[model samples]
Target: MSDPRPVPQYGEYATPEEVAALRGTAAPGSPLLPQPSPSPAVVSLRGSTLRRLDRPVTIALIAFGVLNLVQFAGVLLDFEGFLEVATKGTSAEPIDFTDAARIGGVVLFVVSLALVLASAAIAVLMLRQGRIAFWVPLVGGALSVLAWGVVLVAIVLQTPGALPPAGA
Candidate 1:
């Protein structure tokens, strides 16, 4: 038997209901439109509030720490040599590398290294939490300097001729 429906020259366009029915989302008689599929979600490893300074500050802090640690290590290895180089242009004289001075150098190195590591870790944590963390490195540097100064002062007091004479 021949089909009775007329053949159109143009391509057939299915209605919304027909399309939904074909997908089994709705009955062919229903007027509702098909719901759109959800788009993929995006994930971020770091917080959105990370400032431009965060990364630079962290790097600078680490660099400073490493440099300071290297210098401290050199001083610890040759306490008298470090003192001579440090006092070269100044009126101050290099003190004998006594046990006290060696101890002080060790203390300074340990404290400074610890502070640097701590500050970097804290800054990273703050960044992860979306907090402003630029101050961490600055504060750590200040504290490290203070600790070094205090230890140096104690060592100098223990060993004479570490500094220039009061008259000079």
Candidate 2:
């Protein structure tokens, strides 16, 4: 069976007979021009397919940034404490391990800073309704993982067993 359909032409308007033929409905008294449906930002956003998909990623990135800031502060403070105890005379203490930790701490600081900055960038993109914003959280998440690794490494290297004893 040949399915009868109305043909909508761009240059010319569609007549009632054409619409009737296309829709398989009754024809109107006059020709009906196809009007573009409104996809306003506000209305489209309510049920946007892309936004629905990105909602989880954006939330995770934002939360990750917040957590990073907290951890960043803690890392810096702990590094400072380690410095004070390390500067004392060469005892059986793990002050020597501080050097390695200092390096790890610096890495964590840079990674944390990057996470915060990346999150902001992504947020700006998202607010502008851009797809690039969706990738921002992933970058921050990666940085978070790196920062965690740095902390773990630093902790392992700073353990007392790895340090020189007193009067060394």
Candidate 3:
């Protein structure tokens, strides 16, 4: 009996069965079809030389660094006044302004200098994409936040007549 359909020639539209056969004939370990190009995100992540910091962390570091520098400037400009405001009602007896100002100014200067240095180091590390760059900002930002909280608490605690009297 004669076949019902004409035999398909090379380069003709292939049947599903013929396509399957062709796919099976491909050499082992070779793909039958070309791979799609990688997406932009994947491409960028590959073979990267520098480490990158998140935007929020970088901004926080810069803000804290500037704040410390500003605080240092304020202390330098008015050491006695800064001390008086810091110590205010927290103490019973009066503090010697001159002596305390000298000591407080030194401490503030050192702390602010350290903060600035840490900020600069973190910024460089971030640019270089160093692994340790992440931790530096995290720790520095936490410390900066804690320091600000303490200062705020001290100011609140010393607010003139904030608390009611012993009886009422």
Candidate 4:
């Protein structure tokens, strides 16, 4: 029994007459049809427009710099209090710790002030939108994070033990 439906020709939708003309010219039992040329692959430039690391690094730097500035402000505003709290319990008498704390606070305040200035400069550079601004923030931000870590460690170390030992 022969099939009732007409066999769909290759490139059937390309042109109405081309398919029929080719069908007539093609030898029976030998399927041959002109293949359509492959289209040129399209390459998009959207991904290449911006540097991959620029946006993320810039944002990270800004966040870290802001955090550093806040820490600097804290240290600046409460230098004496922080020093007293840190030295509290470790000393035989409060008077013994006072001079040492005053010196340490001065040193820490100076360092914090420097960090704040550097962070501010980097922020200003970033605002200018120069190409080099991205890198400036990256380095500055990394330093800010490191400074913050140092400050955090110092604070943690200085604070008195909150609880008794497990055996006690």
Candidate 5:
């Protein structure tokens, strides 16, 4: 190793001035330093009505959310009875809409119920103002809106008289 020039050697006695400086009279190399303090940029959303739910409750809500909202679209779309001739002694043409609408309504209602639970979980997550709390709720709300849009499209696309695509 190269010798360090200006390096202090062992057995060197400390001066009274150096000792005082070390104690509290030390000069700072940089005078512009700021004292350490807690960060002031914190953000939070815990006050919303969604924080009351526990994990298991939210898990159940999520499951129902996916099931009801997701299936609601399929039911609204009338996937069944889309390609068939009128049966004898029955109404003209394929109009099997009873099942579709009922199922769709049930699914959507269930999802709406689950959304309440999801709201609770989201509220809980926000209590600490953790990074996740901010994004999770924002993203979830957007996704739920998108899912509703999809359901609307399904409803529009599959009116009673509408037919399914070929081979569907």
Candidate 6:
């Protein structure tokens, strides 16, 4: 027995009549083109993928910011003691923690903490907007370090006696 079903000769998409028409053969019936259906919605993977990656990164940023805040606060709270301990093992001579040095330490702590907080805030905003935000925290941490160096340098420049002589 032969199957009664009509097979598409050109491809599954082309009806037998359409294929026959393309081949210059007379179609048994008019091969009307099927109406095109609306295209399926395009699902963007970027937002969802970034959201998944953002959670862990945000958490890590929070932890890092908190840890830095605590350390910076501790150093600020015990400015002189922190300096003494920090300089103990170094070959450099004892540092004179002057009033200017104390002020610089406070400025450093405040600026660094502010940067951390600002970065965390910006990262959160970026994450909410579905943008990659990991770089913010890294840049913030670097800026904090830069602030620390700048403050320290400023203090040293203000009080040249704060450091030992170049030979010593």
Best by lDDT: 6
Off by over 4 Å in 6: 1-51, 89-91, 162-168
Arrange candidates, best TM-score first. Answer: 6, 1, 2, 3, 4, 5
Please identify which of the two predictions, 1 or 6, would achieve the higher TM-score against the true structure: 6
Would you give me the overall lDDT of model 6? 0.74
Model 2 agreement with the true structure over 9-86: per-residue lDDT tens digits: 778787667768879765665345554466776666656766776767676667767776786676554664665566
What are the per-residue Cα lDDT tens digits for candidate 1 across 64-143?
77787776787765655676678778676545646777777778777877898898898889878967787888899899
* Better TM-score candidate (3, 6): 6
Q: TM-score of predicted model 4?
A: 0.38
**Model 3 Cα lDDT, one tens digit per residue, 1-168:** 765979878888976655656687544334775646798777665535223334445656666677767766766556657766877787522643554345445555566567667766766676566443445655765675665555445544555444456798
Q: Rank the candidates by lDDT, best first.
A: 6, 1, 2, 3, 4, 5
- What lDDT does model 2 reach? 0.66
Model 1, residue 89: distance off in Å is 7.3
Give candidate 6's error at residue 112 in angstroms: 1.7
Best by TM-score: 6
lDDT (Cα, 0-100) at 101 in candidate 1: 70
- Show model 3 residue runs off by greater than 4 Å: 1-53, 86-93, 130-134, 141-168
**Candidate number that wins on lDDT, 3 or 4:** 3
Give one digit per residue, the lDDT tens place, for model 5 in 94-135.
Answer: 554445444455555555545645754775665455323434
The backbone clash count of each candidate, in order, is 0, 5, 1, 0, 5, 0
Model 4 lDDT per residue over 114-162, tens place: 7656765765666566443456666655665575567555644454453
All candidates' TM-scores? Answer: 0.58, 0.47, 0.43, 0.38, 0.35, 0.62
Residue 146 in candidate 6, Cα distance off native in Å: 0.6
RMSD of each: 14.2, 9.0, 12.9, 15.2, 11.9, 12.4
Report how far residue 36 has shifted in candidate 5, in Å.
8.2
